[model samples]
Target: MRLSFTTISIFLSLIRAPGVVSQTGLAPKQFLNLPLGEVKPAGWLHDQLMVQTNGLAGHEHDFYDYVAETDWTGGSSYYSNLEEAGSYWFNGMVPNGVLANDATIQSQTQYFLDYVLDHQDSTGWLGPEVNTTKPRYLWGRYPFFFGAIQMVEANSSLAGRVVPALHTFVKLANTMLHNNGEGLEDWTNTRWEDFVMTLQWCLYDFYPDGNEELLLDTMQLLKSYGDPWEEVFKEEYFPKTAVENLTNPFPFLTWHGVNMAEGLKALPATYRFTHNQSDLDAASLGWDLLFQYHGRPSGIFAADEYLAGLEAARGTELCLVVETMFSGSYLYQVIGDPKFADRVERVAYNALPATLTGDMWSRQYLQQQNQIAAKNMNPDPFPTDGSYSNVFGLEPNYPCCTVNHPQGYPKFISNAFVTSPDKTSLVHVYLGPFSTQTTLADGNQVTVTVDTLYPFSDTLTTTIEAAGAFTYRVRIPSWVANGTISVNGAQAEAVSPSNGLHSVSVAAGTTTIVLNLPAEITLEPRPHGSVAVHRGPLHYAFDIARTQKVLAQNAQEARAVDLEFDATVPWQYALDTSSLRFQYSPPASGVLPSPVYDSGLPPMSISATACQIDWSVAGDTFASPPPTSPECTGPTTNITLWPFGATKLRIGEFPTVNLTA
Candidate 1:
């Protein structure tokens, strides 16, 4: 049923839903100051990408010991293992904006490189690894080999062949092929994801390997996964109501997660050679649907171990958040869609921060939008009533989310800027002096230096050396007021680039632009039901520990129960808007477990003046709850009523309050 007017007003007034749109395009390459560690947070996020790589790094042996080694099964792919690996792999790369650097960052980086060296069969397919029993490496094996190619591309000095990774991949691929008529595994063109796999394979397939057998098999495979990634990721077989199981079954959805980035495989070749529309569309939909059905306010899916129906509370793993971001960036670059980029930023900033505590000491194995408490962490975390509101500390169940969560921030810093096709400067994110001597779009050795304190303040200045009428695009968040762009300090209107990007011209000399962001607050209701408050991209919660609750005057006991909202401290989040205060409190004297008051419920509702806002939402009924589950608790007992978003056992739709004589 649709929301009534009162509920709609509350929902429309408080809720914050991110528009389904993209952010800006490329930032000035130099703007991403990677050396001085100004972007340390983002790099930390990147460190997570090769989480398996770093897992390998944590060990003396690359293949043997992985970070989540005991728990993570990257090889057991397209299954639970695939869900784990795909989730983590997605995080390890994207959120952190992984640079294709050497082994310093990831341990599995070498594993992939070595897998290529060791597994190269007589034929061409590098087949990242062998299923000896099966024909292909489980999960997206092509991306596995492709992962090595990315690392090698970052470092040219590590040489052998430009396509050494491909050489190894080809050998293994050939071993599984039809050797004259006795097809090795009897695989006489048993068609699978050859096109998607070979999209990355073909990048090096064209590189000249003496082995013709391996080459032909790859060509056959390349034609398989043509360009469905963009379309397929967004395309759903059924809607929420259409599906029988509201939650996805274990085995079936795992396949969807691994092959999630099928379309993005075409980017390297398309960027290097062809402008394929199919490639772009495939990449777009691949990322779109993930956010659509599974996205949380935290910028991740409701997947503890796998993708859940959208808005389902007990979902979203740190591993998945990181990997989704990694894939999101790949899609963004390939499709050049700004919306994907925007998703990257929002999730990186808000959701990513809460995943790992500010100190980096604690992490949740699984993060949830309705999460109010941290529970036991293990292979997967189980959420209960208590787990909703308590923000105590690091959980015990699945500690991988803890160890792996730290990378979300550092990786975000790394992802802030990407290499432009021409490889010039950087894309400006957050704002800071970014310095790097990378190759720009013009093939010239372009060195860029940018400096700004962004988000905290809004004036960015950049210095470019590979002179010409070089154009740089700076993203102005929709939150900001539109203003004129100033070159070398003169005001001029800058052209809007992709979705959220602004284009500005720069000369050899320093060009300064005053990017303006206006401080304005807006609201939109949730797609499902209920209302949530937000300022900008930030969600608001009633910080109970910080505020006062209304109490009875005859309260002699310190554990006073009869409480209500406080009028003294207005809802700062509302700005000029005001909320009516309840003059009484819940009859329990203080917060308690299983807060069922007003009827046979434990929390007997009584209206009164509030002691503080933080202690409780200082207001009356937005809309009355239908009725509480019948329970009999003794009278004069204590019960806790946490703000809806703050505590797991919160009562947003409270029982009706009546005045006490």
Candidate 2:
């Protein structure tokens, strides 16, 4: 059922299908997403993706039982009690395989896609659940198709087969929705937005032929049955304190951290269909409240399982980190807000990498901002998580993060650059080393190349080549106070950005525009009178030397082992903020290290004067919140801090020291 690439492209162009704006009068998207592989990673980003390919992300399907022997591939049952792990792996692996263009990964992806498509039942139900009286959970299909559709977009040859199969499933989904959402319950009901998002993609992009009304109806019905995220986001319903501390029986679904992350864009996604202002307002309010109450220094909200509090010791789940990145990217594309892009970069650059090892083999189920050690915690801070939750392992406390973490950077690369609705312009939403090629509305072939260390280095060089002139927009992060842009190395001019984006009239042919955004060291005040170090997008953390012990080894890969880390030196430090200095040492060979996140390889660090403080561990496991105006217990000495993502053991939030005290 596969169609040739030429046929699919022609078919897409001829369709008057509701793209950004559907025939049902949906609101137009501010920015449109490019296909999966259109934006390619380069430089440090490329190295990072390669490292992911050589690590768990690329090999999960080969050895991981959840993915390797899952029911999605004709096995009897999923490894985990929840049947979504295979889908998670697929959702992540599709982009990684397509973006990396790795043969082995691509083959694995094709094999799974072939099996799933071929196994579709006559009832139009996808997956291995069939003919049992047991309640069917359609939630797994949401992530599965999320990856499937990307594969279709990346490799258009899958369009004929995948599109029709998707259309069939939509028909069944619409039927089920009409019957009061038979299978939509619990988690599925709370997370209906994921299904709605997929439906919108089909209605707008694929032209579900005569099923437009059906798709629209299904979206409305799903919203009616789904969690009232819009209503819950209101000030009264939104929990200001930690879920555990609240006396009222708060809707756990609303407070569940991963759900909050995925639900952040739920109303915004609904706004596209309803075009209601309240939906948009509610969406924005939810974003603010989530962070205001539960936000961490690493640009993620505390949700070790449910919404934790603002305390630095509270753990944030790895699933929440990647989901927040996705939701932020979605909000930026739909709402066209620069702040959303900034948040996405913050999570990607700091929290995402901080959760995983440098090799991407091992990962923490939960990461703490003031983490001093990566070991099983007996009296852990997380209200809903277990002891192994904070340890670095293959499956630590839960398998969800293990299967789900792969999508973080791969999807980040996919959404790095987006096109304007009319296709007359391209916007660099999230700055990184990537390039994009797309045809503009005027029938001009445009290629944009961005080369820079970005987030680590302040300079970004963008080379634009087009058959004709077009508008080029680069996002000016909220952090940058004075950014400069030069045309072809000409005299630099101050960049006056509107709504956090600076636009330039790019002429035809190759033109190099170098942008310099100088950032000054700043301090973010935290709870308990502690402060976090920040310069540009990277968060600075005190690099604590740690000794790692392999608790267990993976049967498939010896290198992929469960790790327990203990700080070798003291991690209790109070910084003298006045003495902080930013340092940059470019690579001697002018090449970034293979694993950019490896400690000391980032080539950028901060030197500051600090002294060991009397900070003690909570329950002798996690570091307690920084003491309020604590006296220094040791002599002051110069200390070095690395990027938060570079250090596995670190103190991201430090107490301020008063030398005269």
Best by lDDT: 2
Would you list the C-alpha lDDT of every candidate in the order shown?
0.38, 0.84
In the range 547-586, model 2's lDDT, one tens digit per residue, is: 8899999888776799999888888889888889999998
How do the residues 334-432 of candidate 1 rate in per-residue lDDT, one tens digit apiece? 555667666666565445544443223333445555332233222222322122222223333443343344344444555455555454545554333
Candidate 2 pairs with clashing backbones? none
> What is the Å distance of residue 63 in model 1 from its true position?
14
Question: What 10-residue stretch in candidate 2 is worst by lDDT?
Answer: 14-23
| Global Cα lDDT for candidate 1 | 0.38
RMSD of candidates 1 onward, in order: 14.4, 7.8
TM-score versus the correct structure, for each prediction = 0.59, 0.94
